[model samples]
Target: MNDDLKAAVLERCRRMEIPLVGVASTDRWEHPPFLPWMPEEFYPQSIFPEARSVIVVGLPIHLPVLETSPSIYYHELYKTVNTLLDQYTYRLASFLTDCGYPSVFVPRDGYGSIEVLRKNPVAFFSHRHAAYLAGLGTFGVNNTLLTPEYGPRVRFGSVFSAAALPPDPVLAEDLCTRCMLCVEACPAGALDERDYPEGLTDKAACAANSAELARRHISPCGICIRVCPVGEDRERYGRTTAAGDDDPRRRRAREHVRKYGGL
Candidate 1:
């Protein structure tokens, strides 16, 4: 394994102000970490034949902004984050290629639009799964990756590289508190009260909700992630309770933000 290369990658991420970065050997995909794993076609090596390692990076969603869900503010933030993820991964891939390791970046959201997602409800690549394998987080009941820093309130992007970089160990400790806040808050009734894999998301229902929100110019209904009490971000933002139970002043502020943003 290239320890020096891994150090250089870390330094680059630090310089870029990227908060989270992890590496995983492509072989991890061959060995199933959980049952009902994604098909072989979705693996990093399958997409890029020369890939020996996968690098995953995560960007956090601000809890305060996300609290104003189904609003134009959150929608714009979502788009901005996705754009940055794609750009960052592309830059990372180019950096690796310059070092003689051929690499390719995967788009943050591989689908054309919410309408396409409403029909298929699956992406060509799964960044959540990549983040899990890269040891950045673990799967939560809501079917999103939960990190100690940001819970499900984080977005991920990945790069496939030919360098045999040392891989980070998968997280052995589960970060989810099983509070069911996400399940209860899902506007689409898409989440269940069981653990992940067993409590897989109703992607079709979720996407349908997003489709309706799209018509209103908000596209993503982030209620589930917003209510999740898993991350230290909750403490950072001083959010003491779930969404609907907030103080009237704060509740009214969110309601007002929603009223003007969409159809």
Candidate 2:
């Protein structure tokens, strides 16, 4: 039955253009760092007490075009990924319901009210971590999931189901070491040696910096992703930028010029 379900899910994912998929036991992920948003009673087992399995899907977000203008392009890419994820998640949920297995979408928006953020500083466990725990990829120093194929260029979504499915054990390798390439590349100074001594991460700092970048509108930097050795190696990762190598912020203002052959 597990094999049949796995095959069916894979087929559906392929049809939907989701490149990666994995499954894990909801039981394995019911604790503080994992379930930071919900109370203990709202754990997967408690909420969907019968749910024995979870199907995790990953959609790659590494469009070379995003690298050209990290601020604008990355934000736009994030929106696109979220839209795709929501559609795929709902489709999977409906499929499970039709098969007589109940399912629900885990909350994707990481931020909640101020009270929630204060109470749960780690309120948002890394989405990539969820994907990794579900055996989708290895954890990288950037605290992003690094798949063998796409590296850190992906977004994750999961489905909890009552149907019993064999679990994919956690991946063996911890791809991230003390190497702080991601830390060094962060223009926002959000990362530090002490916070992620062994590459654990401080989510709040990262979030704050990201927020500031959005507020300032000075070419939101995804330098971390750009410098990630894994992503750099992938030939498919290339960027489209305005001519003359001006700063991305300036280049963006003249995007129309480049497109229409006007200066």
Candidate 3:
């Protein structure tokens, strides 16, 4: 493994102010960590033949900003985070290539649009899964990668590099509490009480809900991640309680924001 290359990559990420980063060897994908693993086509090596290491980076979504679900405020924030992920990953890939290692960045969202997702829900690459193998976090009941710092409230992007950088160990501890808060709070009834694989989200329903929200100019409905109590983010934001919309003042504020941003 190239320890110096890994150090350089870490330095680059630090300079970019990226909070979460992890690396995984391409060989890790060959061994399934759990049952019902993704097909070979989704593997980094499959997509990019030159890839020897996969570097994944994540950016957190502030809990306070995300509290305004289905509103333009959160919608814009989601877009901004995704945009940054793409740019950061792209720049990192360029850096690695310049260092004599061929590399390429994977876009944050591979799909074209919600309409496209409604018909075909799967992305060409799964960053959450990549984030998982890279040791950034574990999977949550909400089907999101739960990080210690941000839980499911983080977006990820990946870079495929020919450099065989030192890989981070997969987190042995599962971060999910399996409280089912995400399942119960889902507006579209897309989630189930069971753990992932057995309780995989209903992508069709999720896409439909997003489609409706898009019509209102507020695309994503981030209720599941908002209600999740994992990560120190909730404590940091003073949102320890899962009871959202119970406070009249906060409810009114959310309503006020929703009214102005969309139809």
Candidate 4:
């Protein structure tokens, strides 16, 4: 019955057009540092006493759209993806409830800001960690989850439920190329091109840069994600603005992103 339920959940996510879905058992979790907004009890089981599983789902941010990072095209698409994630996860949570399993869906981003993050340096929950545990991705030097299909150009949401589901294995192979393109591309010098959790990225620097971008109404500094060379689209997108800054291809891609109104 548990296996059947898990399969059903995966199928439902697929029906909802979610590109990636992976499960992590609550027992398999290890809590990260807590932020001020995070309650003293911060584990999955702590959030929902009966939570037995976490369903992590990924939404791909169109590669062409991300090529225009820190631009209006990418910024709006970013919000659209987040909205889709929140709505779909809410639907999944409701589906679980209908199946006799209560659930809670986590937002893609919430309570995160330059001021708040500077003080706390963490979010109440980390969906990137959830996605990592679910075998969907690994951490990159940019402090984002790197996936095989889209690198860091993906957004994620999580659903914690009482339904007991078999946990997926954590990915054994790392996906990042340790390319310093992201580190160099970072206008704010936020990232230190190391490796996963050990690679230190200055969250304050990142936050400040993002805030400055927001001041201009862009609201995001996606230099790191823009330059990653992971995933199938890497060759198509190229690794850095310097690689082909004036390439007619680059300009065409940006126009394409704008034409579509976003990804």
For model 1, the superposed segments whose C-alpha errors exceed 4 Å read none
Q: Which ranges of candidate 4 are over 4 A from the true structure?
A: 31-40, 235-246, 252-263
Tens digit per residue, CA lDDT, model 4, 1-263: 39999889889987888989999887666553222223445667877788889999999887766777767887898889999999998999999999999998888776766667667777767788788888898878888999988888889999999998888888888887787788888888888866656667888888888777776776676778877778766655554443346578777776655454322
Could you give candidate 1's per-residue lDDT for residues 52-109 as a string of tens digits?
9999999999888898898998999999999999999999999999999999999998
Candidate 3 collision pairs: none
Off by over 4 Å in 3: 243-249
Clashing pairs in 4: none
Candidate 2 accuracy as lDDT: 0.63
Highest-scoring model, lDDT: 3
lDDT by residue for model 3 over 1-263, one digit each (tens)? 89998999999999999999999999999998997899999999999999999999999998877888888999999999999999999999999999999999999999999999999999999999999999999998999999999889999999999999999999999999989889888999999888877789999999999999999998799999988888888777767577455567777887788787887
TM-score order of candidates, top first: 3, 1, 4, 2
Tell me the TM-score of each prediction against the true structure: 0.97, 0.75, 0.97, 0.87
Q: Model 1 clash pairs? A: none
For model 4, where is the 10-residue window of minimal lDDT? 31-40
True lDDT of residue 251, candidate 2: 50
- TM-score for candidate 3, residues paired by index: 0.97
Worst 10 residues of 3 by lDDT: 238-247
Q: What local distance difference test score does each model get?
A: 0.90, 0.63, 0.91, 0.79
**Better candidate number, 1 or 2, judged by lDDT:** 1
